[model samples]
Target chain A: MLSVNVRLFGTLSRTFEDYHHSCGLDIAIASRGDIHDLLVHLDLIGESIGMVFMDDKQVNNTTKLNDNARIKIFQPIFGG
Target chain B: MNIVRVDMNARKITREIFEPAFTGMGGRGLTSFFINREVPPGCDPLGPDNKLVFAPGFFSGSTLVNTSRFSIGAKSPMTRGIKESNVGGTVAADMARTGISAIIVEGRPNNGQSFILKVDQKGDVTLHDADQYWGKRTYDLVASIKEFYGNKISITCIGPAGEQQLSAASIQATDRDGRPCRAAGRGGLGAVMGSKGLKALIIEKSATNAEPIQDLEGFKASAKIFAKAVMDDEFSAEILPELGSAVLVEPINAAGAFPTRNAREGQFEDADKISGEALAQIIKSRGGKPNHKGCSGCIINCSNEYVDEKGEFITSSLEYETIWSMGGMIGNNDLDSIARLDRLCDDIGLDTMSTGVAVAVAMDAGYKEFGDAKAAIEMVEDVARGTAFGKILGHGPEMVGKHFNHDRVPVVKGQSIAAYDPRAIQGMAVTYSTSPMGADHTAGWVVDSNLEAFGGTLDPFSAQGQVENSRNTQIHMAMVDTVGICDFAQTGFGAPDGLENVCKMIAAKSGKPFCEADWKSTGKMIIQTELEFNKNAGFTKEQDRLPRMFYEEPLPPHNKVVVIQDDDMDSTFAF
Candidate 1:
């Protein structure tokens, strides 16, 4: 199993309110899957998440995450 | 609507018709136009020659959501360049209701004959003596004014810091609750207001009519669709209320771009303690008002009324920048202390970003230890009390660095950069160096552009392709500020149909041919004019470079440095 650290921000992690401080989780993904697949596996809707960062750089659905890659998800936040 | 000209040197008030060139313009468009045309280049920003122009946005007086924002423009005493700062509050709404295109305050008062100018509902303007209110805290001053002139009026005034003509002073404006909270908080415009010796601008709430719309029905249709888009967006409706812009804390920290300890590091060890979710949890536990609107027509309500653990209000709209500035950037994890610092900045009328960054620089110079909340709060007290030490800090980060002989100052064009660190966000590096407004986050926010999922397709760690990212986003933000709506309301404006809806509103309001493409073009024009003004004011492409420290030091955990090349930055405005 391949593992990735996922962190959701803004409304993207609202459902996990109980885990506010620990919204970041280490989850397993299939070797054949990408970020979209990982989102689906985690029961998260992709459209609700605005920007996706992999190890502090932006990533796309097709960007393959190797084992233990870090992912940060944020709602399309605009205000400063 | 006409222009009201108040001559402070002459102590005369005269109403003048706006020139044909400026008739339909408002917000940044109007403010920049007036400033670029009227004020001579290279004049002292605090001298008698500089004129302060205040103009409400085109849609401000209407029933539009998030349109209650106005622009204040002058040559910056801080940056010594053209500056336009916009704020959200009832002032814009009330000022628009006063039936004025812009209010131009020119000339300096002689003989210390200071007065508060009142623009009443019936278009009557009067100047009243304001001697007794000098040197008062902004909240108390506002309360006393509200009590005297009814609780409904909106006011814009500077505090004792401004009265002292400190470069970091900000012009405070009243929010709906009569708190002198919202601020046009950049470029030391408050010092400009102080130089004029005009104590306050009281805008009486009197207009009951909506702004005249050419295509009223069409505007209504577009507005309804846009409002629904805003209200229905998950970010605006859910996260904004739940956490506010402070939501960026966790994600930015996780990404190692949150600007910890005055940009020395990209991440904070105590990030979770100051995260928006943590703040929201605290507010909830303390029964503090969470998810409040900062302005009259704001739909997102990204602002909040932060309170102490005793459930007393501390500050309104304690923003992400403030949180990072006083929290992560200064190494302070105490949210209550940060809240107190926020209140201190607001009440004393100082730019929170500049104040926080200056204090951080002082800490770097061994003035105090990092993470000392007591020391940080005391520095603010020094500013409010106008101490000799406070005078040095009040000059902003550049001066603070100079005073302490520290070389690692984080600033661009004498203005301190905001929360987002350039080492992690290369697009932001371009913005920090190139923005005519000097390192402002709102001038060009491109965190999304670095994400390929949103069409960025650029590597954020290097100099490659970040110029176009910063340029496009900067132009877009120029249009956003020109339109005078809250930046969070871009949820509506960012959607596929958002531009069409916005164009319809502008066309209906201005009775002109407005289209989606005009946003970029008009935005480009405003930026070009500002750049030209800055050039004439003696700014070189050299000043458009980030501090040496940014490029010299590698920020962890990414361990990247500022790599955006110089030629690309110069081409940002080449068009």
Candidate 2:
């Protein structure tokens, strides 16, 4: 059992939430499951969501997740 | 059907019949064609041999939404290379309505006297004395021209930097709100215009009965479909209109692709201060409008005019690239100061992106401190004034880097890179490297990973599938530029089959038959022609490379260096 949190920004933020908050996803996975599998378990699709961070350090979508590792996901939006 | 040639030396205007080869091409294609056809290769870009071309897209006068883009082309005095800068304004539509396809300004004035070009109905062109408007900024100069030519005339003008013939000068265009807000702001086209002793071009919207299209109804149907797709798409409709393009700050920052501190890092510490949310908040608090505003017949209305606190005017069309280049890339997070600097760049006829990069390089050289908004504003002002240091800054990032002895300048083929750092977004790295224009993001913006999800061995991080993606995107963008449509319209209709309807519309209008594949081929042909022009002008595969610093420095967040090998870069153009 592990806990992960996600937050959206820009278009996703507007469409999802006003500020960063916990996603509150609790799931039971086999030992040594990676973050990619966790994202699938949490129903995240492709690069539609841009950056993923684990405990403040940037990580790719395929990064492995540890027990009780905090995660955040942000979606793409416009800028110059 | 006619080409207007304005000889600055003789102050004479000559007209010639248009050739069929140049019938459909306009904007970038037209500029490139003119440069390749008329200007001699290896000629001094700042000398009399160099020619400046102003051309509107083929469908500029039509009811096609957001099709009012015009291009300015010149052998760049800045890059000493081929240059084409495009902008959205009413001048293109007005020129099309007045039955003019292109305007070619040639030869410098022998006596060194400056003048303005006035074109009205019946194609009458006059060179008016512009000594009084000399050294005036574009904002004030535009107002003076409007006051004299009446409110309806479309004017393209330059400013003090242009009058000084600085290498970084841009050509200014009037936006919907009558501000000199839009610009062809790259490669010092304004310097070319200024070298011709031209101050401004005032075009009167003529009521001439010139209908070039053959099938209006079919064209209208195709245009409607294209417009519907853009208006209905989630990205174009909801996001672009609501936030303009500046909304990418947060996402690109989070992705660690945002260029910061002169491309030294991919993330900004003050990202939240310059985020799109901050911009939206400012717009809402100041009673500013954030909806889509059209350029000519455009319905997408992705352009914005933002006002600041104290209810004073700030800037128009506050874009994402400009914000990033001036804000994060330079390490300046003051929004109001950034807006003021944007206005200064617009008034001086300079590319904000290049200017921002140059200023940051200046800061990195210890000329100014990082994140000093006041110093940044003063440095830009110095460029407008053409001071000694200003000349260094106005020459662009490469020159600035050279003068400062900084080896980490992030330029490709002498032109500064856009907002996205190549070390972070490797797909855009391919674009910056291989693009003929050199470091241009619009050659192909490869951030569209959500488009139908084509499964393949195409990895975004590695340079594995970037070549094909860049080639495909270049073709698509070329088609969009030719039709005078906004690139945002392609979000809904960028696919091969989607372009079929657009080509059908073009065919109907031109009384020709064009299929989906024909449209695709047209894009390929445009790129091939551009590539040939660049190759002839001395560009080679060696020029198609990212700066060495990108390969050396590991960007933050991801902390990944661009590990693309030289041979892999050579294979990008393997066709």
Model 2 lDDT per residue over B417-489, tens place? 9988777667778878877777888777876541112222355567667667777877777766776766666
Position B267, candidate 1: lDDT: 88
Docking category for candidate 1?
acceptable
Top TM-score prediction, candidate number: 1
Off by over 4 Å in 1: A1-8, A16-38, A50-73, B20-24, B209-211, B453-455
The candidates' DockQ values read 0.43, 0.24
Q: lDDT tens digits, residues B295-321, model 1?
A: 888787777888887888999988889
Query: Number of the top candidate by DockQ?
Result: 1
DockQ of 2: 0.24
